[model samples]
Target: MCTLTCIAISLIIAATIYYLRFVRTKPKLDIPSRDRVVVVSGAAGGFGTAICRDLLSRFNARVIGLDISKEVMEKVYSEELKQYGSERLSFIECNICKLEECEKASERIAQILKEWKTDRVFALVNNAGVSNSPKCTERMGIVEYPEDELLDVFGSNLFGHVRMTRLLYPLMKDGQDGHNGAIINVASVAGLLALGFFGFYTSSKFAMVGFTDSLRREMKSLGKKGLRVTCIEPGFSKTAILNLKPQADTEFGRIGVIREKKSAAILRNAQPPKVIGDAICEQIFSSNNLPHLIIDYWYMRLVYLFLYYTGLDL
Candidate 1:
């Protein structure tokens, strides 16, 4: 009876602790975002377009979208220009991977800020990335992967964003100019997990995850009290990331795509990319000082948690 009583009491304490730590809801904050300048890279397709729309329509902020695709830019511009007009929404066509292109893009942004009479940037969303499709070859590991392709992935996913942050650092000012600044990096769940056949993509995201953490620490250490750096990791979503075409029809022949029952079930129920936009909008200005948000399905959390703890091969 004594042992039973102690076990029950311990269970109660553990439950209470868990509830307070992870189950309790944190308060959400809404910063004054109206008319402020927000920059979103990869702002043409996938979650980029949706994030820009949310910032423009919901926050009523002046948004400058940076995208590499001119064709997509023309289409999005035509649609959004009618609603928000040039003062609130615009797009710049520039490849983020190229330093000169990013420089040109920043110059244009400077002109916009000068015209708008705003010297500070409110936010920078580094959401652009690329993935290599698994070719039907015998490349079994990172050693078999082409070195150039690995560099390309890092160029867009990590280094390009780094360049943007460095150039825009002066403009952000981290509330020194009275408006709080933010940097949101959009990474995939693959960043957290080592998914097979995504060596290049996963490596880049892992680097991004580490960079986001270090950047946050750097901001605090530098006494930038108003600067908040965060990273968002999304799970399987119906986005352009899935546009990689495997040459063969069979499940194994397709290289990275697994078509077994469990895997198919996960893919069949992939969430739309727009949810990512809504999630980021909801959390962008929250005062909880959140380091990262794992926007994924319910079971995904369990799967990753299990895999994370047990060192399971599956």
Candidate 2:
């Protein structure tokens, strides 16, 4: 009888803690106009560029745009991003997959900060990823999935973010008061949902998702105060990241068929990358304290819940 009573009490205590931790209501935040600094990788790409623009325009944040291609970023500045000007933006041409390059990039950012006299990186968006897809797993067995490609993909998407964060750790001056820095990792829905013939891409995203989760814990333990790590899982956004062929193509080869199918699915559910960029901006300024952000269309929330409850591998 006493043991049963003790068990009931413990259950009640656990329930109360859970409710307080997750279900407590909080007021919405309206952030003040303050200086914010951000770094965005893959910034030459459509989505990455969009995100950079969103942060700059919406939040008035200083942004460092990093990418392997200098010409694309230059064009972006001359054409689409001309009005934003140089006062709020800087570009670094670097291969994120290379640790040396990322280290150098970090040094450059530090120099910029020292010149400008800033304290920390307000947010770092790991928005870079690649997939040599439309090729099935069997076809890619040796060429793409070989040790080198595997290392390259994982290094760029997963470990590169790790290295960047490590290099910037000392400068993350968030959480001293009500402020905290955020790290957002842009993962795909494909990482959570298993898809056939996407072995390499899926594997790399899963590793990234895992790495972000583990890093979140480590950062918390280190008491980064207001430094928060958020993994962003988004459904398909229409971007060149999908590597779509032009609409004029007539013949459907094996690769074309695969791309056609994937494109159709993505197109149906795709939201503008601006939507995601806006959400990320909100996260940086809003004190909502969300664990992760899922940008999806249609019934994706239900799908995520169902998959999670079913014990499916992430």
Candidate 3:
């Protein structure tokens, strides 16, 4: 009897996977270069820079990168972007947390699209964020949790995405075919698994997942069939966040200590930056066919499956 019950459960689960993976959605398609323009935040970092490089190399699409640190942009690219066919790549110093700066960045990209005679941007990648320390309510003890710090992370990871999408909707919203564009928000495994070490960071990313899910539903309701929403949940790719300053740090010099250490350990076990870069490019080019993707290691994927199906609710 138990064996039969287990078999029945297995069939039900397999059917659900089949429906979600194939039946409910249309077959995936790629976005053509003629209609592609990519706007990526945090382009100064290792993963973001790789993503930009892949986009240019693969799609021949015009790319605009926004970062908080001008030095990061200059140092990270260092004329390498110029080699990817001149003037096709550009970078602006803009903090995602600031709305006015985000608007200015959007305006700059809009102008470029206008010059190219492109009606809308093909993709917007929201990858800017800060790692937060794990300080749950129990860990806080008598000390009050800093709501401002929490809000700061949310501003960059969540609200900034909201503002960017709201600003660029017109460009991505399809006029003729009703197929719009794509929005890719870079989340983390920490968000899904609730990393005990980075409680606040995990919370912010979890919120982002919810935000992206709801946004995707809303877009569908609005009949924007062409618009795609993707949440990038990376399980530690080789990146330089180790040297980057933390958003909540009082002294930028010693920021990301725990994260840097943890990330260094993770680097020993993690995949290369190119793997994630290739995945992001795949997402951009093949989003029409497979809009929702969880790009991670096999073990992570198995754990994700268990959590998702078992309703572990991570």
Candidate 4:
């Protein structure tokens, strides 16, 4: 009990410092709404939907939402976005994993920009990726993982976003005269700290975190420029990606499968997905955004701190 208390106190102190450094309020983006053009991938998911609507409501800006499946896109998003006319919102059928597909998307988006008479996209939100939804995909140990399964996970989680960034980040670079351009990638806490029973998914997120950081540093060569790369690490949120119904009739005796269920139970206190969406929008439009924006509770942040200082394997 005493040890736990000490840990809690230390965490509280760390969180206080972190809040002061990264969470303090700042001035809103001082740009005209007419100049804002945001492209969001995986826009049909729970958080994706919230991000699209929030951007439209907050800025009345042009939003392009993309999902791989045409059917899912049509089913999840309504044709009529009230208040803001349908003109402010558009949905695209895109598969970011395919290079050719991403190229085609760029051409289409370029046409839209020409129509909007805007020179560039203000931000690109890379929120599409697979998680522990199927359950079976995560049952393997590191060596037990099949080559094909690993590629599929990385294809959606890492390569897809890389493709999107390569093709679309140029738009952000050439954005309006004074506007800041942002590339926000939604990674998971699983990436920040390795968790058991999530081999492929965790590694993919780890790679994403690394990629975002490297990109940020490389872009810094522009010398005090406004273009930024940010990686958002979120814990359990009320999203179908992680909270999907576990498949039934499976053998519960499997060790990894049981462990996965236990992890899900411990994550019963997931915050709503809106918090994440709002955070992304706020960070984008804020005068400055952190290199890493974490969306979990204080204790989770504490764990991250502990790992950082001690270098202890969790």
RMSD of each: 4.9, 7.5, 6.0, 3.5
Candidate number that wins on lDDT, 1 or 3: 1
**Runs in model 1 lying further than 4 Å from the true structure:** 1-27, 133-141, 174-179, 224-226, 247-262
Which of the numbered candidates is closest to the native, going by highest lDDT?
4
Error of 4 at 239 (Å): 1.0
Which one is best on TM-score? 4
Ranking by TM-score: 4, 1, 2, 3
**In model 2, which runs have C-alpha deviations exceeding 4 angstroms?**
1-29, 79-81, 133-144, 174-177, 224-226, 244-263, 311-314
The positional error of residue 264 in candidate 1, measured at the CA in angstroms, is: 2.2
lDDT of 4 at 277: 90
Residues 165-227, model 3: lDDT tens digits: 899887777645444577888887666766543536678888888888888778778764547
Q: Would you give me the overall lDDT of model 3?
A: 0.69
lDDT by residue for model 1 (1-314), tens: 99667656655664554345335744266577778788999888888888888888887788889988767876866878887787887778888889999999888888888888878778899999887532323323455656676777788899999999888888777464453578888887788887766557888998999999899888867664647888888888888776654423434335544533336667677888878887776656555536777776655655554455444544
Query: Candidate 4, 41: how far from true, in Å?
Result: 0.5
lDDT of 4 by residue, 62-172 (tens): 898888876776666664355555467777788886788889898888888888777788889999888632324335565665677677778788998999898987677
lDDT of 2 by residue, 206-278 (tens): 7778888888888788664746777777777777655543322223234445555754764676778887777
| Model 2, C-alpha of 99: deviation from truth (Å) | 0.9
